[model samples]
Target chain A: MQIVLAIVIGAAFGAVLDRIGATNPTVISGMLTLRRIRLMKTILLAIGTGSILMFAGQMAGLVDVGHMSVKTAYVGVFIGGLLLGAGWAASGYCPGTGVCAAASGRKDALFFVAGGLLGAAAYMATYPAWKASGLLDGIAGGKVTLGAVPGSKFDGLFAISGDLLGIVLGAVFVLVAFVLPDNLTGGKTPAEVPAE
Target chain B: MTLDWKLGGVLLGLVFFAAVLLVKPIGVSTQFVILNGIVTDVVNPEFITQTDEGYTSTNAYMAKSNGKYAKNAANPVNYSFIFVLAMMAGAALSAFGRGLDREDKRLPAIWKANFGDTPWKRYAVAFLGGFIVLYGARLAGGCTSGHMMSGMMQTALSGYIFAAGAFLAAIPTAMMLYKEG
Candidate 1:
């Protein structure tokens, strides 16, 4: 039953990803470079809207707090995130987008998938070393939220209601999305600018 | 035809929201690991073993979670794995819906402007980028979708921090790589 639902939901997610220009490396790199920010604005809007809906849903009992999965806070997580960002800018595809792009018939994306598999395999081979380095150790209370939510098993860093905090932050993101200019560089993208 | 970016974004938000509300938070990278395990297990034939207590892997990473990862790799037909596959199918469906005559079919315009029109070069870059991104994702225990998008939505502090770290490096790296336009 869940598997069938996964197909429906996953399909919708991929379709949305494709439609948003996420499957295009050009759009991604453009956003990263601040040359073109239509995609970034879209991203911000999506996240903000999602956050508002999710947090509000939780509060309204429409969403389950128990299903909330909080990743362990670790130093490696931060470091890995930095690495992923660099990769994202260079390749213009994250894992999900890469897969979607490949399916969308971007031949380069197939190579990306191959490389990703190899990378994951490499991580598996070296997992013990990372584990030994203690980088995976949870920091600041292993799994925690910024604000406290009533039903979740995780702790909150602050006493404020997490649901409300989420709503506020979400709103802020939406505001930023609305206010942000199309291009931080105040010029057309490289493709449109023409070679000098 | 492609949807407007803002509309697409809202739809994305709704899709993510619906997934979380109905099931578990959406994740993709872990499936990469599971795929690796499945391939390795197939090759070695002894990489994973189904025991009296479920499943276990020769690799410690897979052995964690009481062999939960091992189980996924061994079984290979569960919800998460299917979700990832379905994601691909959905993307293909979307592309087909777009008529395959979309602009930037082979190479997007901006990528060509900066990197030139070499398909192999783009492929190499894409490969390297995918490699590094997945490595980092595994290291961080999540990727953009898992940590940044879903995590922030749930208001997890790690999510916020990961987003900060990602942009911190992403922006500079992007600037360094493509100084044109």
Candidate 2:
């Protein structure tokens, strides 16, 4: 039953990612460079919107706090994020987007997948060193949420209601997506592209 | 036809919301490690072995989590792995269904403008980029999906912190590489 759901859910997620032009390297590159933000706007809006819904669902009793999975906080995760960002800009794809792009017939994405697997293997080969480095040790009350929910095992960083916090943040993203212009760097819009 | 960008965002959010609400949060990068484990097990049979307790791996990392990782590697036909496979299928269906992602125009326009059309170079860069991203993701214990996107949605502090670190590096990196654009 879960496997069937995974397929349906994964497909819907991938289809939506492709439809939103996430599978396109150009748009991703454009967004990162601030040359174009059509995709960035979409991303902010999506994240924001998702935040609102999930939190709202939680408030409405439709979402369960127990199901919420909080990743452990550690120094290495922060450091790793910096490294991930550089790669994202250079490659124009994150793990999920990269997979989707490859699946979308982008031959380059195939290489991306290969590289990712190799990278994972590399990490696996050296996981002990990192673990020993103390970077993986719990930080900032590891596995904590911003607000205490009624039932989750994770701690809360603040006494404020997490659900409320999510809605506000999400609304801000949606607002930015609306107000932000299509192009930030004055790149050639589709209409402005020189004819071949 | 491709959905409008804003609408696409809403839909994407809804999908994520549904996933989180119904099951677990939507994450994919961990599967990369599982993939590596599976392949590693193939080359070195002793890399992973079944035991009375359950599956175990010679590698300490896999052996952690009480052999859960090792179990998944030994039996790759699990939920998350299958989800990843399905994600690819979904993208293929979307891209190929419309026949829109044609081969000839594979190289994106901005890339052409910045770095002439050299397929191999792009491929190499992509490969390097993928390697770096995955390595970092593993170090961070999540990727854009698991960390940035899902983390932020759940209002986890690490999510915000990770987003900061990511953009702090991403903007400069993008600016450095995409000078032409």
Candidate 3:
């Protein structure tokens, strides 16, 4: 029964992604070019909404934060983050988006997948050398969460959370949504863009 | 011909449930192990020694290593493969419903002109891209599906990192390759 439900959910997610034009490389590229803000808005909304839900769930005792697995601290993660940011700007589609794009039968997505697979294989082939390095060494601290932060990660994070930082940043995204000119937009919905 | 959002929803739900029921959970990162195991066996079969009672075969080795080298790896007949297959089927079904599956001659023309008009380059690049992502996924210990979707669902910090890294990588890569005419 659960299995059936999962499949349905997965399929729906794909459909929503398609409907949103997320599977399109142009849509994603538009976010960076400021030609399309829909992707950014959609992504921000998803993240913000999901975060709020989880926060509320935890406070209400409906969920436990302790059970979750967290990565040990690594400088590599930060470097990887920068590389990823650069890659996305260059590629236009990340893994999920790439998969969806491929499913949609888009040809460009084929290259995206090709680049991704090569990157993965390269990482594996070089893992032993990397693991031996001090930079990638793992710290003992495990299961860290936002609640532990002295300054909230959410703060200045689009500015809507009651928490001062969250409210500030959360609000920025909303403000950007409202104030940015259509051309200068950081994110927009699929309906806002011209069709490919 | 319109997408039945409800049907898409049902298929997604089935995939997740099927994964949990049969293979513990759904995430694309695990596929790396299967690929890795295959590479390992092919590259150096002598290194692929039997470690457990249930999985004493090469096939078992492939699945087990892919799943965090988990002992008692989930059955090969699990839903990950099935879910991917179903996704393709659903996409095809939706395309057919929309009358959009018909071949566009121009599509091939674009590919021929840009991608060297050779099958080998296309396949090689595809394989290389897959390899890169798998490597990153392993280094990060998860993929976008595992770390981003599942990880964020659980609110793990690493999930955020994974998501950030993936999006970060994707945007630039696309621009470099796809921005041209």
Provide DockQ values for all models, in the order shown.
0.65, 0.69, 0.23
lDDT of 1 by residue, A20-81 (tens): 77877777877898887888888888889988998898899988888888888999889999
Candidate 2 residues A75-191, lDDT tens each? 988899998999888888899989988877787888888998888888888999999999999898999888876667778888877778779988998899999888776756443
Candidate 3 at residue A147, lDDT?
Answer: 34
Weakest 10 consecutive residues, lDDT, candidate 1 chain B? B99-108
For each candidate, what TM-score against the reference?
A: 0.95, 0.94, 0.64
Q: Which ten residues in a row have the lowest lDDT in candidate 3 chain A?
A: A149-158
Q: Candidates sorted by TM-score, descending order?
A: 1, 2, 3
Give the alpha carbon lDDT tens digit for every residue of A1-196 in model 3: 4446435554655555565445544455556655555455554444334344444444455534332344444556545555544554444455665666566676655766666756755665566676677657653333333334223232111223333332333344345434545454343433443323
TM-score of chain A of each: 0.94, 0.91, 0.73
lDDT: the better of candidates 2 and 3 = 2
CAPRI class of candidate 3: acceptable
Query: Which is the winner by TM-score between candidate 1 and candidate 3?
Result: 1
Residue pairs in candidate 2 whose N, alpha carbon or C atoms collide under 3 angstroms: none
Question: Which stretches of model 3 miss by more than 4 angstroms?
Answer: A63-69, A139-142, A148-194, B1-30, B33-50, B53-67, B70-74, B78-134, B143-155, B159-181
Q: Model 2, stretches more than 4 Å misplaced?
A: A186-196, B101-106
Q: Which stretches of candidate 1 lie over 4 Å from their true place?
A: A188-196, B101-103
Clashing pairs in 1: none
Our model 2 lands, by Cα RMSD against the true structure, at 2.2
Residue-by-residue lDDT tens digits, candidate 1, B19-118: 8888888888899999999999989989999899999999988988899999999988898999989999998898787665454666656567677878
Model 3: per-residue Cα lDDT over B122-168, one tens digit each: 44444455445555665666665566645554344566666667666
What Cα-based lDDT does every candidate model obtain? Answer: 0.85, 0.83, 0.48
